[model samples]
Target: MRNVAVVAFPGVQSLDVSGPLDVFAEANRFLLPDEHYRLEVVGLEHGPLRCSNGMTNFADRHFSEVQDGYDLLLVAGGPGLVHQEFADEIYAWRT
Candidate 1:
């Protein structure tokens, strides 16, 4: 199974994260039901991630703690995208 990690941070745009997640989920549902991508919503730190609109999302794991075998890493963008801290973090793992 493919391990996919979706990176979530404060002020991240919902669509940026949800769009690919929806597509991946649907594709996995039809194309690889028996063995498919394992999706993980990860945060930079271990806590709730507040969106640009103020909605909070609890993450499954911290970015530092994520296992090393992921097949894909998705970085969500929004107002937070301009932050240098987030950029550094994303660049560190983007391949």
Candidate 2:
């Protein structure tokens, strides 16, 4: 199985995160159980994430909680994303 991590933050564009994930999930339905993509929502911190559209989402795991590496990583973007600040480690993790 492929471990897929979708990174999201406050003010994130919902589609930027959900679109790709939904595609992966839909693809899983046609594949065997063992070949399924394991999708996980990863947040910078724990608790609820309030998006730009005011939708609330809960992350499956926080950055600190992620110990294993993912086969695929997706970062959600939005207008507010440019205004937000994050730790250097978060950027380093992507590399």
Candidate 3:
């Protein structure tokens, strides 16, 4: 299976993370088991992330915990994202 990680943080736009993931999930149903995507929501810290719309999303993994490189990495964005600061480790994981 292909590993897909969606990076999320506080005040993230919910759609930015969920929209594309939903599409991939739906497509998985039509693919073979080995070709399916294994989706994971990664966060700065492990726990809950509050979105711009007040929705809570649980992090399947945290930046510090992620070791394996994913087939796809999606960075979720929001109005507040640009104004926030992240640790060097988080950026390193992305690269």
Candidate 4:
């Protein structure tokens, strides 16, 4: 199975975290039993996270604590990012 990590934060748009993941999850229904994606929500910190829409969700793992490499890493985007910059480690990871 491929490791898919969706990076989210305090004010992410609910859709950004849920939408594509829904698609990936649905895709698994038609794929081979062993050939599937393992989706996880990664946060800067591991614990409860509050979203822009007033919804709360738990992160599967803390970003800094993610030692295993993910096959796919998707970062959620939203209005809350208007004044925030991606952490330096994020850029390093991308590079």
Cα RMSD, model 1: 2.5
TM-score of candidate 1 to 2 decimals: 0.80
- How many collisions per candidate? 0, 0, 0, 0
Name the lDDT of candidate 1: 0.76
Please write out the lDDT profile of model 1 over residues 1-95, one tens digit for every residue: 88887888888887777788888888897765667878888887668888887778777888777657678888788885776364466457533
- Alpha carbon lDDT of residue 83, candidate 3? 89
Each candidate structure's TM-score, on Cα atoms with residue i matched to residue i, is 0.80, 0.91, 0.91, 0.87
- List the pairs of residues colliding in candidate 3: none
Error of 4 at 19 (Å): 0.6
Candidate 2 stretches with Cα past 4 Å from truth are none
* 70 Cα displacement, candidate 4 (Å): 1.2
Q: Global lDDT of each model? A: 0.76, 0.87, 0.88, 0.84
Candidate 3 C-alpha error for residue 81, in Å: 1.2
Per-residue lDDT of model 2, residues 14-69, tens digit only: 88888989999999999999999999999986799888888888899888888899
Positional deviation of residue 94's Cα in model 1 after best superposition, in angstroms: 8.1
lDDT rank, highest first? 3, 2, 4, 1
**Colliding residue pairs in candidate 4:** none
lDDT at 64 for candidate 3? 81
Q: After aligning candidate 4 to the native by TM-score, how far in Å is the CA of 41 from where it should be?
A: 0.5
lDDT value, candidate 4, whole model: 0.84
